[model samples]
Target: MSVVHLHLPGFSFGDVPVLGPLTLTVDRGETLALTGPSGIGKSTLLRIVAGVYPARGTREIAGRMAFVFQEPTLLRWRTAQRNVEIAAKVSPDTALAALTEVGLGACADRFPDQLSLGQQRRLALARAFACDPDLMLLDEPFVSLDAAAAEEMMGLFADLRARRNMAGILVTHDAAEARRLATRTLTLSGRPATVTADVHAAA
Candidate 1:
């Protein structure tokens, strides 16, 4: 099934064009990665697809969707478990299970400030998973983590994707990260960004 379909005639800032005409689709259980230079409108395109940014286009998304930003964006006053429960609108039991799945059950009572950066990212993943989304949108989700932490987080995400069979769109500048996580990658470039390359990973 097609999880997302976007046909963007174009997108622009007040006077400058950010993205040119484009069309893309993601199917069930597929991970599509968008890679491009910084400030090249990759994130902007993501927001447009998420309906967080208004644009003139045909944006169709099927089933439930969840987004994980570069930052964890957790509530500072809420405990880890509570963050998941509130953001995901899930029961306490479901939230706890989600925490456990992300290796955060032991720190469920800790607030965002108390957990390390990597742990906070895990909490974000837990919250997203608890929503039981059919499509997951991630924007540079592993940006600041150290090598080991990034690897672990990638592994966790891969496992979750396998278990849930969820479609995903990942935005990253790292080609290696895209190859590792995405089944297909689209590279955007030019003055008004457009897909310049579409490569499928070797199975």
Candidate 2:
């Protein structure tokens, strides 16, 4: 089953065109990675898919959706557990469970500023998981993490997606990350960005 379908006639920022006409779809449980040079509108495309950005296009997304931005984008005033609870609109018990799943249970009472970068990322994942989303849109989610931390987070994300059978769209510049996590990869290029490559990973 297809979880998302998007047909973008184009997108622009004022007079500057950012993306060209494009159409894309993601199947249930599939992970699609968008890769391209920096500032090529990869993240913009992601935002369009997430309905966070407006464009001249059609977008159909089935089931609940969650977004993990390049930064954690958490509420600074909220504790880790509260962040999940509020964002997911779930009970406290449910929130703690989500935190535990992401290895943030011990830090649940801590504020976002109190946690380490990796721990903050985990909390972000916990918030997303707590929402029980069937589709996840991530924009350079592991961008600033160190190698070990990035690897761990990737493993965690893989496990979560497998458990939930979720569809995902990941925007990143890292080819290895795309190869490891995406079932298919799309490369965007040019002044008015358009998909230039579509490669399916070997099963």
Candidate 3:
């Protein structure tokens, strides 16, 4: 099992305590759902761990890192398959295969503009999977999907998890997803964020 421990501090509030030296760990083959109020640094924590933030702390990330931002973050100008093709070591055939897994193979020739929001997110997921990442940083992955679509997307993630012993730190607002996907859960403080509660779910 892989464990991640993080410590971060912030000092921009009027009288709020430092954000952290927040510490948490997620084991391999498990998903950790991170939920908290707005502006509580949920995404910030993921970005910091993703190596996008230069804040003070030590992080231990195991294996390849793939990131799915709040938005699809796909190249609008590129075809669906082309986006994954450009970033990963996928050959043309493998890129198609990745898209197929996410049910986007028929839209292979289509660009980002032609797809629906759910489709866009699925494409983003395909691109991440194409890289064969060992860990994924998913920021609200099912934000735009409807209930049926959301369940399907969750299933897709489960399939991906099954393919490998990958772990995810998912930043989402949905408690259902937190309960459904995460083996562990953590809630942060409202103002000056600190890990207020840490919960381990029954798997």
Between candidates 1 and 3, name the one with more favorable TM-score: 1
RMSD per prediction, one decimal? 0.6, 0.7, 2.2
Order of candidate numbers by TM-score, starting with the best:
1, 2, 3
lDDT of 1: 0.96
> Where does the lowest 10-residue lDDT sum fall in candidate 1?
158-167
Off by over 4 Å in 3: 9-18
User: How many residue pairs clash in each candidate at the backbone level?
Assistant: 0, 0, 0
Across 93-181, the per-residue lDDT of candidate 3 in tens digits comes to 99999999999999999999999988998898999989888788899988877899899889898787779777789998899899988
Give the alpha-carbon lDDT of every model.
0.96, 0.94, 0.83
Encode model 1's per-residue lDDT on 76-123: one tens digit a residue.
999999999999999999999999999999999999999999999999
Candidate 2 lDDT over residue span 77-188, tens digit each: 9999999999999999999999999888898899999999999999999999899998999999999999999999999999988898889999999999999999999999
Candidate 1 wrongly placed segments (more than 4 Å): none
